[model samples]
Target: MMMKELHYSGSFTVNKPPSDVVNFITDLPRAIICIPNIINYEVLSKDKARVRFRVDLGNEVPIAELRRVTTDAHIELVSASGNEIRYKVDGRAAGSTISISLVIKVEGVNNGSRINWDATANLGRLLQMIGRFVNIDSLVKSISEDTIKGFIGCLSK
Candidate 1:
């Protein structure tokens, strides 16, 4: 099996202070509930959780079963201090391994706050098989962007 990597980085602003943003992010139970497509989740501790979610692979994977897969991940909040939060994730879906590192930085801006985030995902096995025929990276990227946007939108409210 081979591995492929995908990277994502973006920023958004909301009408909230940096401390408020940091508090919300560090409060995993409150913050994680905002994530979209979550089938179920369990808070393992103060900074760790197990989440199950469904992924819509769309029409890119050829087979229907492969088009929509359920994935489970273990997420750990590695660090949260000041205006920054970091997480490490490991998961499996469709018989493949997935590893991710994510970071979020908050900055005060004009009475509000700006959230800057970056993530790198390493996908194994499943992506290699699907990549031979479809642009899996783009498909995954699109899904990831949508999920992130939805999460941020939830926080904004």
Candidate 2:
């Protein structure tokens, strides 16, 4: 079976210093709250966490019928440098092992900062079949954009 890869990259400007932008994002406790539909997160260690997410099934699926599919991913903070933070996420979502590597870079722009981010996900055959209907690209882009916005918004004050 061939594994399918989904990729996304984008840049956004934040109204904060690079240090503050990077610090706020790398801080999970302060960052998770900005996410939508994040059921909860369990910090296994300073570098590892298992995050639960709630996916809306919409009205088609009845209340008792698979309303929420939780993907428990073991996320690890791989590295944090002056310009970037790298992370890895491994977990099973929809019965397929999904692995993702993400890198976020923050550089000083004017008085604020410019964030360059990219993420790649390896989805197994199962997810590829389901991926057709999942709109993974849109989902990823939306999440990434919101994450940056959320981080910057929360820290600007």
Candidate 3:
């Protein structure tokens, strides 16, 4: 299948220090739970995991086959230092291959930390076909952004 790349970035503040944020994120078992729609996850090691999640296509996609799908991804921490962390995820979704690279940076602020994150998603032909009918770009971005927001929100609590 063919691949198309999509990029997204966002920043948010949490009521915690940079160290706390880094620690929480680096703890694979704890941090993975914050991912949205995550059905199950297994920590393979300190920096790797197997994750299964479901995507909700909402009412936009007219095709029932593409409306809701479950995908499994292998997540690995590529690097982490100070307040920055990077990860790579590879999976298959809707009969297509998906790969994602994510980077997160944290900065200490007054009484909390500001987390900035960006991700690149390489999607396969199935999504390209789906895009022809709906705004797949927006849907992907919304889901990506929500995942990050949810992660930070959960960590803050």
**Which stretches of model 2 miss by more than 4 angstroms?**
57-68
Candidate order by decreasing lDDT? 3, 1, 2
> Local distance difference test, per candidate?
0.84, 0.75, 0.89
- Clash pairs (backbone) in predicted model 1: none
Which residue runs does candidate 3 get wrong by more than 4 Å? none
Q: Per-prediction TM-score, please?
A: 0.92, 0.83, 0.95
lDDT of 1 by residue, 1-157 (tens): 4467788888888888889888888888887787778999999998999999888877856887888888899989999877889989899989988898999999999999998989999988876787776777777777767767776776778
Best by TM-score: 3
Name the candidate, 1 or 2, with the larger lDDT value: 1
What's the CA error at residue 56 for candidate 2, in Å? Answer: 3.9
Give the Cα-based TM-score of candidate 1 against the true structure: 0.92
Alpha-carbon shift of residue 21 in model 2 (angstroms):
1.2
Judging by lDDT against the true structure, name the best candidate: 3
Question: Clashing pairs in model 3?
Answer: none
Model 1 accuracy (lDDT, Cα): 0.84
lDDT over C-alpha atoms for residue 54 of model 1: 86
